[model samples]
Target chain A: MVREIYQAVADGILVGGVYALMAVGLTLIFGVLDIINIAQGVLVVLGGYLSYSLSTRAHIDLFAGLLITIPAMFALGVVVHWAFIRRLRGAERTSMTLLVTYAVALIVEGVLYKIYGANNVQLSAPYTTASLHVAGFYLPWIYVYGFLLAVALVAAVYLLLYRSRFGRSVRATMANETAARLVGIDTGRVGALTFGIGVAVTAAGGMVFGATNAFNANSGYDLISRLLAIVILGGLGSIAGALAASVFMITLESVVTIWYPTWAIAVFYAALVGVLVIRPRGFFGRKEVRAQ
Target chain B: MIGERGAKAGGLVLLVAAAVAFPLAFPDPAVTNYGVFAMIFVTAASAWNVFSGYSGYISLGHAVFFGSGAYAMGIAARDWNITGAAVFELLPLCAAVGAAIAVPFGLIALRVRRHTFIVITIAIFFIFQLMAFNFSFTGGSAGLSSPFLTWQESVYDTRFYYIALACAAGAVALSWLVRRSSFGLRLRAIRDDEDRASGLGVRAMRVKLSAFAASAGLTATIGAVWFYYVNQVQPQTGFDPLFDLTVVLMTFLGGYGTIAGPVLGALLVEPGTLWLNTQPQLAGASEIVLGVVFLVVVLFVPRGIIPTGGEWIRRLR
Candidate 1:
């Protein structure tokens, strides 16, 4: 029983890493832009489809496909920002963005449905089925790889935010957009670039996710609900908070599933409410910084 | 001014009379079925508008209340052996169940900011959906059927149509009343600026909770009626988050926070979607069109039709 519990926890941590990777993009966009990307889930699914097509048609490795999908997704993000998101202004921008992004989600979902015909598909590779034996426990290779990739990407994001010049501008914008603009940060450029970078990370997350779980276009709805819960629990715009919350939630869900499979999903959300009641701003959220 | 007021009152009376007589005028089963769905959506949208439209706390989880009401009716009919007249008797119980769920849901969810609140609602909604899928009493994913209403096929659609119309009218009237009350002012103040409202001695939490509860109850009542109308309840059909989104979109498309907005939105969107559904070539076209319309409306007419039209009229005058 103890061994099975340990396995569940181990499996959860690996899956949680991928969740963190997906959530980081959402938090990054919220931190800098003050807009919740309701379309983030669909974007992740789009990344998965991109990877799926490349792996199947071009015979590219799942990890190697990111090289192409990342840039493509980034460009898509930039176009979306430039076309629809750029025009939003004034006090109602936050709520308006929610509706606009939802519209974006619908359009993308419609396109995916039109092409894919509502069938569940997954990215397949030898690694997807292989497991590593470590200390009398079997660890899936895709999960291990996914966790490592998530860690590397998260570290890369941290370095980009804290160690690079562009990172400095992003932080400045996140801190105070008006001040960033006054300092000649070209806040609009920063917003667009940050949104692009945020979306780009979904390629890695999506590849890992699709490899593990079968997904259709409609899967984005469930994915968005889960991702939103993770980010909210992590403190909407806090990167580290997203990371911590992801692992915590996934672990809790796995643990609950071991004992009470029926209530596992409910427990995940129940924990969110329980945590928020004690700390409404979330784990790493600043109290005064209301989502405007 | 008096003439304008009289004209407005006359228009309202005429509108009500028209609405009450609609099913009679068009007794075709197809038309009545469409009317039933339209009225149900309008009621749900109005219920959504009462809380989200006024308080700026957009709930993506209203399907929870809606599904709860539906499940309540389903369980009562199936488990408790309630049938025929007893099925109608379960309406209040279903509504109370909705309000009951809303109390705890609102307590937990209302503590967060609007953005976070939206996330919480989504989370809770998924939780309910998952529960519905897992719990055998609710019949799991296979779902439960209401006690088959023995109404004749000829009058069945008409009967449900009137019930739906009544529900919609009650919901709209409730929304209209709320909008004109001090509670409505408090909700609007919270939407404008929560900190400022609270600073001015408004009990933001209580006001929001009451509105949320009221909205849930009304929505659940409609959901119960819908369950009976459809005679079946599935997790996918009952707690579909997309249903919540559609209602929200309808409210927004018509004009969030206005009395006529949700009604107008339902009028436009419901039939439009039904028409799209009927077109054999356009299987998924409605969502795409709705998406484009949503983007355009948010970008160009964020204040919605009524307010924007009112502005246009003022400009012309």
Candidate 2:
């Protein structure tokens, strides 16, 4: 029993790492642009589809496929911003973004359905099925690779934010957009670039996610809710907070599944509500969140 | 002033009478079925507008109340052998169940900011959906069939049509009454600016909670009626998050925070969706079109049709 519990925790942390990568992208966009990308889940699915096509058609390795998919997703993000998100202005921008992004989600989901026919597909590779025996627990190679990739990308993001010129602009914008503009950071460019980068990371997250779980276009709906819960529990725009909350939530869900399989999914959300009731700002959130 | 009030009241009565007489005038089962759906959507959208449109707290999880009402009716009918008039009488119980769920749901979820509140609502909604799928009482994923009404087909349709119209009328009337009251003013104030409203002693929490509870009750009543009309309940249909999204879209498309907006929205969108569903070549086209419509409306006409039309009329004058 104890070994099974340990295995669940081990499995959860690995899966949670991928969640962290996806959530960081979401949080990054929220932190810099004050826009919640409601389309994030669909974008991840798009990434998975991209990877799926590349791996199946081009015979590219899953990890190697990110080199192509990342840039493609980034460009897609930029185009989306240019076409849809850029024109939104004024006090209702946040709420308006919610609706507009939902529309974006719908369009993408429709296109996916048209092409894929509502079938669940996963990225397949030898590593996906292989497991590593570590002590008494068996760890899947894809999870191990996913976790390592997540750590690397998260570190890269941290470095980009804290150690580079672009990072400085992003942080400045996050802190105060008006000030960032006054400092000649070209805030518009920063916003576009940050959104692109935010979406680019989804390639990695989605590849691993697709490999781990079978997904169709409609799967994005469930994914969005779970991702949103993670980001919200992690304090919306906080990077490290996203990391902590992802692991915590995934672990809790796994443990619950072990004892009460029925309550696993519900517990994920119930914990979110309970936490928010106790600490409205979340674990590391600011007192006054960016209001819509 | 008295004359103007009388004119408005008379107009309202005329409108209600027209709506009540609509299905009878048509006399087609298909048309009446469409009427039933349209009326149900009107009530649902109006219920959504009561809280979200008034308070600017967009709930993506309204299906929680909707599903609760549906499951409540389903359980009562299946377990207690409820049928016919007894099942119809259970509408109040469904409403109560909805309100009961909202109390705790609102207390916890309402504490967060608007953005976080959306997340909480989605979370709670999924939780309920998952529970419906897992709990044996809800009959798991297979769901529960509503008891037979034992009426003639046309009579059943007519009965449900009237019931749906009454529920929709009640929702709209309640909304009208609320909009005229001080409580509605508080809700609007919260929507405009929560901090400022609370600073001015509006008791934001209580006002929001009451509005949420009221909205849930009305929505649940409609849901219960819908369950009866459909004669079945399942997690997918009963707890569909997309249903909540559709209601929000309808309210927005019509005109949020306005008395006549949601009614107008439901009238237009529901029938349009039904028409789209009938199209053989355009499978999955309605959703894509609705998405584009939502984007176009939000970008170009955020104030919605009624307000924009009103503005245009004033400009013409």
Candidate 3:
């Protein structure tokens, strides 16, 4: 029984890494732009589809495909900002962005449905099915690699936000766009790039997510809710918090799955509500969020 | 542009007359079905707009209340052995259930600001959706079906149409009354600036919660009628995620916060969607079109039609 529990924790932690990858971009966008991108979930799924296309059609390795997909997603993110997000102004900026992003989600989803049809597709690499025996626990190679990548990306994002000059600018923009603009920072360019980078990371997440799960165009609906839950639980603007909350929540769900498999999903959301009620700013919310 | 109060009254009379005459004039099952659905959305959009639009808390999870109302109707019918038209009596029960869910849901979700409120609403929504699917009494995945209605087949759509129409009227009237009331002013104040509103002693949480409950109850009543009209209750249809999106789009299309905006949005968008859905070639393209339409409306007419048009009228005059 203890072994089984350990396996669930291992599984949860591994899967949590993929969730962090999906959620970090969402948090980053919120942190910098002060607008929630409803399209983040769909964008992650879009990332998966891109990777799938690359791996299947071009015979590219799954990890190697991210090189192409990330830049492509980044460009698309910039365009999304320019066309849809840029025009939102006035008192309803935050709320209007919600509508605009939802519209963007719909468009992307529609385009995806038009291209992919209704069938579910999964990414395949030899590593996807292989398991590594480590410390009496069998961890899938894909998940293990995914966990490593998640940590690396989270750390890289932290560095980019805190340890660099551009990071300083992004943080300044986040702190106060008007002040940042007064300081001669091209806040618009910063927003575009931040949004782009936020979306770009999802390429890696999507590749892993699509590899692990069967997904269709509509699969984004399911992912968005879970990603939103993770982002919220981690504190909206905190990437490290996202990573922490992801592992914690996923492990909790994984352990619960051991007994009441059917109830595991409900428990995931229930835990979020309970946590939020107790800590309205989430686990590591507000004070340590975003900037550092 | 409608400039005078008398002109507005005349327009309202003409519009209601047209709505009343719609199902009777058409009588086609499909056409009446469209009317029924349009009316359903009218009620739903109005219910949704009352809180989210007025209060500026954009919920992507209003479907929780919607689904709850649907399940309440279905469960109440089964547990009480009610059947036929008599099941209509469960409207209050469904409304109460919706309010019951909303209070706790509001208590938890509304504690946060607008953005977090949206996220938490979604979390609570997933909880309800999963419960409906997993719980044994909720009939699990197979879902519950309402008892068979004894109404004639030809008149079935018409009867549901009238029921939905009445509910839509009640909902719209409720919206009008609320907008004219101090509660609506307080909600708008909260929307405009929560800190200032609370500073002015509005009791922001209480006002928002009350509105949330009111909106949920209204939405639930409409959902119960819809469940009865459809004769079945599946998790997907009852707790539909898209339902929230569709209503939000409608409100945005017509104009958010304006009383007539959601109604106009529902009357237009619902029928258009139904027509698009019925199209053979465009069958898979409905969502795409809806998406495009949502983008167009938000980008070009973000303030929505009623407010924008009202501004246009003022400018021209």
**Alpha-carbon RMSD of each model:** 1.4, 1.7, 2.2
Which has the better DockQ: candidate 1, or candidate 2?
2
List the candidates ranked by TM-score, beginning with the highest: 1, 3, 2
Using alpha carbons, what is the TM-score of model 1?
0.98
lDDT of 2 at B136: 93
Residue-wise lDDT of candidate 2 within B54-153, one digit each (tens)? 9999998889988899999999888888777778889999999999999999999998889888888889889889889998999999988888778998
Stretch of 10 with least lDDT, candidate 1 chain A: A283-292
**Residue A262's lDDT in candidate 3:** 90
Name the top DockQ candidate: 2
Native-referenced DockQ of model 1: 0.67
B1-317 per-residue lDDT for model 1 (tens digits)? 99989998998899889888988999899988888899999999999999999999999989999999999989878887877856888888988999999999999999988888888998889889998999889999899887877899999998888888888999899999999999999999999999989999999999999999999999899999999888898999999877887897888788889999999899888988888899989897777887898898888888888889889998999
User: Which stretches of model 3 miss by more than 4 angstroms?
Assistant: A287-292, B1-3
lDDT of 3 by residue, B1-317 (tens): 45588898999999899989998789889889999999999999999999998998888788998889999999989999998889888899999999998898899988888778888888778788889899999999899998999999999999899999999999999899989999999999888888888889999899999999999999999999998888888888888888999999999999999899999999999999989988898868888888889989988998999999999998997
Candidate 1 chain B: minimum summed lDDT over ten consecutive residues — where? B77-86
